[model samples]
Target: MILCSSTPHSSPETQPSGLYSWPNVFHVPKFTYEAEFELQQRNIEFETNGTYFNPGPKLKGNLLDGLAQEMMKYTNYPKDYQCEEVAAALTRAHPCLGQLGSKTGFWGWKQSLKYKMQNYRTKLRRLGHPEIRVNSLKHKREGQGKAAANIKKARKAEVNYIPLHPKGETIESLENERIALLSEVKKRDNEVLIKAKMENTFYLRRLEIVEQRPMIGEFKNRWPALFEESEVNAEFLRITTKPLQSKFMSQFDQFSDKLIHILKKKGGVKGQRIKNVLAIKDLCDDIDTRRECILKSVAIYLNEDPDSFFKEYLASATEDAERDISSTVMGIYIIRIDRNREPEDVGVVIEGLKVLKNVGSIILGFIMLFGLIYALDLSFPENFKYTFKFCQKIVMNLDGHKLNTKIQQLKIKLFA
Candidate 1:
């Protein structure tokens, strides 16, 4: 008689449908369920060339019971099985599988192995054995986390990775250094352009002032308010006087004195323009009374309306000045007066000063002050007061008696 162990390696075809083939020899073990599981974990072939797991002879009787007894020596008492731990233990049992890591076919053999373990757990429940489930929920969550990590990596890869510069790009060069260098270059270029423009403007303004200098000097000589006295003298002293074209400096030397006499005769206190005026005996009283009288007459001459004049002149001058400023300056940057504030505006102040210098009338000065205070509603009353006070001091510094007589005579001539 022969004895053979039954294991997963044993099958009817492989065993030849009879008793064990090893009758006189030591019996070989048959294939068992545990050995089959072990083979799957090791990814080894169970059958090859129409043979069982063991291609040699069939095993002896009841190999499954013997293998179970042998396995009990190293097996844990509880025997809780998780997918990876069981895979690791099986690989430990058979070192040949360790090099291959755990081989599954195409789609991940671990998933299929997990289903098998679930079924095994179900069987244990049916057998009235308490369930020994290993915690694989955390491992599943980690797998999902890995999938999410891959998705994030793919998203990051979708961004444009080409370098802006000619050289090969690093992360710092592509992201930070490129922008910083380009921006610095652009800013430096803009600054250079602005500096060039400012230098050009400065030279242009200097040229204009130099060209207009001769003409402006003549105006300053005739119109004292147009320039400071020291500036006028300094400019005029540098100018070389031209020689007389005629063959006589003596001829024109007395010409000015003679002309002054002739002008004095035609235009004097006794002229027809001042025929209604009388000389003042008391200088102080006449100055006080005549100042008021002259102002009233001048107001009548202006039609007693200064607002219209201020508005008309201010608007025109402001418009012209603003246009000139806008045309000369480039870009959005500018220096300008706010014309909406009317006479309080600096443009209006410029026009006023020019008009005052040309008018040369003390009465007109008062009128302008009134218009600025009342019509234009300039809020600076104290400034106006101080300005008029200064003018009054200047007037008081003059020969009051002579000035009073001349003003009275001039008013009568102008109004008559």
Candidate 2:
């Protein structure tokens, strides 16, 4: 096997308090029915309270092997931290499985799972599995020695980041499916077929993304269907197993009232500026306007100019309008489609390219664009980094555990 680094890779520290204490949308993975049946046959007694399960103490080798096999269905290369998370989840579900006298209570299981996963990968490598075979020693570079560079693994809670293709489908065949999808997407009433083809070619798409690292524009051109609003939502769901727009909007609405109240009470120049932004006539009359105000308030609270984050231009302006908008890493480009009235259409620009156009509302545009960022593994723009970070860490509760000082202080005030 191509051994990457012997050293355990460091992950973000889990925050112990503040908004980090909020519950996540991610439910712990449960044991398969077969596994649960075997446990029951082994006379393991357990209690189930909602989604949580508590089972008997002693688990044998066969059980661990089974669990590892199940995990391999999701990812062949589970990172060390992911293993720890699984072990933690396991102990949480089955308190009896906790290792005696261990600090986190599942240290032994974590180590055992790590080894089991390695052995499992070895078996697959021997069987010529494409995913595992790619990581064999023969594929290693001549001068890399024992440690491989640029390890590729899921960064966040991507459950299906690098999944295997469906049975009886090879990489070339999947590529052909992907190629056919390009034309299928252009036709109307083809949603079902398009979605099916997209799902079938997921492995191939991920391989190209992870290996080639194509630019946003290039990738969109090759996989035009993936950029459609529906496909973007579908892709995000496939990766994270959560409905992107619903979760984002629900959280935004849940906290917007409280956050607005908090922002309105600020004392200094920033407070005055936010007050002015909020004072816009009838700002609260429309949901979209209120959401836009909230976004502006958030930027001000974080000491960023909201205008820089959202640029507006006339549709009839010079041809250079799009060129100017493309300079930013990511932003909402409000286009005045009709000079006779308010701008009704907006475009979401990412990586100096317009990814989505004619977005109906500012809040929806932001949420959809943010979903695309997560789905495409794109970095948050530096200008609005904290703003987006706040959304990711707080609203979505994906990696909220570790908060920087600024956001942590804000969290304290918001929750205070």
For lDDT, the strongest prediction is: 2
The TM-score obtained by model 1 is 0.15
Off by over 4 Å in 1: 1-397, 403-416
- Global lDDT for candidate 1? 0.28
> What is candidate 1's lDDT per residue for 1-416, written digit by digit as tens?
22333334443234321121112222323346655455554444423322223211232123223333222222212122223333343334333333333352211223433544444444533543211211122222345543123211101111111101223433344334323333433353354443332222322222223223333334323333213222222222111011111111233232323322332343443332222221221233533234433323232222232222223224446566455533321111112234333133222232223322222232333433332222111232331332222222222211111223434443244334
What candidate 2 gets wrong by more than 4 Å, as runs, is 1-148, 281-284, 337-341, 411-416
Per-model CA lDDT versus the true structure: 0.28, 0.71
Error of 2 at 107 (Å): 5.2
